[model samples]
Target: MPSYLEFFAGGGMVRAGLGGRWKCQFANDFDPLKVQVYADNWGEKEILEDDIHKVEAEDLGRRADLAWASFPCQDLSTAGNGLGLGQANGGDRTRSGTFWAFIDLMKELKATGRLPRIVVLENVVGLLTINGGEEFKAVVAALDRLGMRAGAVVVDARHFVPQSRQRVFIIAVSKTAKIADALVRDEPHPTWHPDPLVRAVHKLSGKCREQWMWLNLGAAPELKKTLNKIVKSNPVGVDWHPPAETKRLVGMMSDENRKKLAEAKSSGKRVVGTLSLRMRPSNGRTIQRTEVCFRGLAGCLRTPKGGGSRPRVIVVKGASVRTRLLAPAEAAALMGLKSKYRLPDVYEHAFKVIGDGVAVPVVSFLRGKLLTPLLRSIKKSRAADDSKARRVARGSSERKRRGQLELRV
Candidate 1:
């Protein structure tokens, strides 16, 4: 079975997407809460609940077929501090700076001849433009230095789920691995290669550009589910806002959003939409306003660190409109997780684990379309080489036996 090492494995969502086909050789994360959640779902046999920097290459045991890192994005996300990914050689000490530690680990693995055949890095789409796109180049360059060919695609969770979370997946393959021609393209696909990513690729240094790959993920699948389908009407762990509070929520809506609410109420049918509070300038003073989206999709789930960033569910049926915090289970469903997936009991802790994870279906799509096929090709190639070597050795042995018989005669 193919094996992988999952870094920054929040709640083991990647393992959930990888399914039982792949063996998880090692998993690491620094947050105690996230580690506990991951252990609850995936067990603690392979999990190391410690900081990435503290992990040594030897602790990873045998080399894995793939290494997946969904590193901290706080420094690289647009909503974050924009500190970038520090230095390529492990200089910075910020949250996102942990990326350098991952790189350093890969370098150590390579030195010890334990480097994985493939490496996948997942993070916010803002990674493509952070620090004027220099950081993206540095990442590709780092892979290049490891003698790997690197390519990336921007995958939005909306394609596979009801959430509008867009993340960039950087897939790097060892230069020695066998890759099928069908898995690459001369140009980028419009869906996966947005303008920012295209620009970032074009900006790579000449040497690194030579190793760049335009991965062909093929066509995106149609979204079969919507926000309404994923959201539970009578969600548990959260209560609906009282009449006065609900009125206040509606009153905070801007004129445009209020019109949307009015339209929903007039439809005479139930409407489910997501609400978020944004600070908008009014009369030269910034005031908080509630914005609602009725496009059958939820706004991207985010860590509920503060009140303004928390997402709310708005249900409008005829003249009555109700609002409430989005349930934890609903958040998990939005990330393509099954209902049976275990989550933390505390609401904020559960939201943090779910929000700070890769969409399960997106990872599954990449696994089926790219990673699995690539690994199969590599295995096939190695098997063929082994068979040829065995035949050669047999021939040599037979000749030696015949020579001995002649000498005896």
Candidate 2:
């Protein structure tokens, strides 16, 4: 079975996606709450609930087939201040600087001849343009220094689930490994390679460019679930807003958003959508407004910090419009987690874990389309090379024996 080392394993969503086919050699995360949740579901056999910087190569058993890191994205997310992975501004103390520690671990693994054959880094799409795309170049350059040929693809969770979470997946293969031609293309595909990512690739240094690849995962699958399908009519861990409070929420909507709500109410049939309060500029002043999405998709789930960041659900059936804080169970459903998956009892803790995770189905899609196939080809190539070496060794021994017999004669 293929093995993996998971870094920043929030609730082990990556492991869940990898399923039973892949063996987890090691997993690490710093957050205590997330660690508890991960242990509750996956046990504590391979988990080390500590900082990634303090983790040593010895902590990881054998070299795994793959190393996956979904490092902290606060520094590179649009919701953040765009600090550019700490090399330029904050100097390794920033949240996203955790990526450097991951790189350091990779370096140690390489020095010990335990480097994995494949490495995958998952993060927000802002990594492509943060600090004028310098951070993205630095990441690719780091992989190149480790003797890895790297490529990146932008995958949106909306393709697999109702949430509109877009994440960039950087996939790197060891220079010594043989990659099948079918797994890559000489040029980027329009769907997976957005303009920002293409520009970021073009801006890479010559050495990094030479080592870069255009990974070909082909087209995204059609979305299976819609917003209405995943949301529960009666959700747990939260109560629906009272009629007066729901009216106040509607009163907070701007002209455009109120029109959306009005249209939904007039549809006669039931309409379900997502709502979030955002501050927008109006006549040189910023004002908070409740925006609603009537489409079949939900807004991207975010770690609820303050009141504004939390997303709410809006249901309209004829003239009855109700609003409520999106339930924790509903958020998990949006993330494509099964109903039986264990979550924290606290509402905020459960939402934080769900919001901060990679969508399960998206990881599963990549495993099916790219990871498994690529690993299989590499294993086949290595087996062939080993067989050839044994044959050569046997032939040499036979020739040596014949020479000894001639000498005796």
Candidate 3:
């Protein structure tokens, strides 16, 4: 089996998806919290928790059969002001520079002629639009310089889970191996075209205006799951009861905010947050509590760093729908994490991990279609090389025998 080294190994999701078929040799990531979670699950493997730039080439070992990197996307992400091509500002170039650091590591291994046989990189779909797609071009050019054939696929999390997350994955292989050109995007298939650009965006025409066109692109694919599947069937009983003050605020969303919701249209009914407000006699302070809906699909899960509050819902079916923000268990289920997956962190950190992870079934599909084929190509190349070596040896023996017979005559 081909061996692999996974970098930026967040919670070991990629490894978990691929490890059933491939052998994982080494893995590394910088986040201590995520490392702890990863180690909790895959403690038997070598886990490196250090700055990736400092990792020695030899540490990756002489024969890295495959390399995986789900590189940091903050630089190119819409979350980061779209500072993709130029020097990333905010005095925090650390994450942006990490991609270069990865390239440097690859160069070091190349010196020993045992660089990874294949490389896979994952990032947010925003990378395609960053700098008008120059960022994607730069990545492809880098792999070309390293003599690796590369292709990219844009996958939506809704394919596996209810959440709508779209991530871009780039798969590359060394030039020494020759895979069917069809596997690359250059060759289009009948059912599914490998060309990502063809499927990148969906264009629509306005109903009233014949001349108007709309580009509704980067939107997540729709899944058959509804909010009911995501929520707990047997909630047992309501917990985290909202105080009276919290209930009042939900009643007080401004006319303007409510109008925005009315303007936004969705096929399924919409849900909105409600508030209950109260004054604290002890501290002479006012507090607001949030109520959510249990009948609709959830909004995106977010990291809870004081700013990343999960969206609340209070109204459903155009009426006052009373509910609470999803409990930790519900959020985990929405993200497709196994119920038994140990989450040792506080609710805040646990939310962050789930928010950052790839949907389990989405990764599994990618492994089967994109990764497994590349690995098989490597094996086929090795076998062809062995057969050619044998043929050459046999030809040499025959030439020697014919020469000896001529000399005997």
Candidate 4:
């Protein structure tokens, strides 16, 4: 079996997508809670729980066929309050410096000559434009220096799941490899030729485009599932806001949203879900403003911090309207975790783990459409080369045998 090494392997969501093709030989993460959830699900799977820098690359024993690093993206994410990568105004760089640690690990592996055949990195799309696109150029150029040519695509999770999460995936292969990606943009596949991905590629510097390959997974199927279908709506509810609290929430809505709420009530549609609440200025004072929607797709899951995460989701079916915290199972399903996936008991922990994970079907799509096929092609080419070598060796032996017979005559 082809083996893989995964970094920041939180919750093993990537593993879920890779399916039965790739065996996860080694995994590492720094978060204890995420490791706890991974252990609960994987059950005694060998995991290194120390910081990446502290772990010795030689300790891995065997080199992997593939190496993946999702890397930490909080520093690169736009959702955070700090400057992206927490860099001083074009001077002091802090949080995003964690990415350099991943670089160190890559270098260490190279020094040991155990670096994997294929390298894949995942991070927020912000990396594409952060620091005037300098960060992204550095990433691709770094791969080039390591003797790998890089290809990139920015994909949204909503296509594979019911959540609108967008992330960028960077794929690299050795420059000396004979089999390479098609690197063409005009393939007939549907989801493979996405607009954002095109934009991402176009934005690369001339040098970045030199080794670029277009990874087209083709048109993904139309998602038949909706947010309402996956939801494990609680019958035995928890954290249901009292009527007065509900009234306050309703009152805080913008006039436009309030009109929609009223329309829902008039239409006798009993289901309601509030997306989020934030402070807004109203008549010389700041008050909370709320937003609600009955849309099919859900807002992207956010990491838990204060009350910033898991806003109220209200369900109204008939005479009764119910409001409560979104169930953890529902959150897990949005991440494409079907079964054999375990959730932490605490709501905050559950949200944190799921929020940080890539959607399973999206990863699975890449495996079936892109990674597996590429690996197969490489194997086939290598086998053909070996056969040619054997034929040449046999021909030389025949010539030697004929010369010996002639000498005897």
Ten contiguous residues with the weakest lDDT in model 4: 81-90
Give the TM-scores of the predictions, in the order they appear: 0.94, 0.96, 0.76, 0.88
lDDT of each: 0.90, 0.90, 0.63, 0.73
Off by over 4 Å in 2: 88-93, 403-409
lDDT of 1 at 361: 98
Distance from true position, residue 404, model 4, in Å? Answer: 7.2
lDDT per residue, candidate 3, 320-356, as tens digits? 3344555667667777777777665576677767777
Which residue pairs in candidate 1 have backbone atoms (N, alpha carbon, C) closer than 3 angstroms, thus clashing?
none
Model 4: per-residue lDDT, tens digit, 283-318?
A: 999987887787767787877677745645766664
List, residue by residue over 124-155, the lDDT tens digit for candidate 1: 98899999998788888888888898999999
For residue 277, model 3's alpha carbon misses the true position, in angstroms, by 17
Q: By lDDT, is 2 or 4 better?
A: 2
Best by TM-score: 2
As a whole number from 0 to 100, the lDDT of residue 60 in candidate 2 is 94
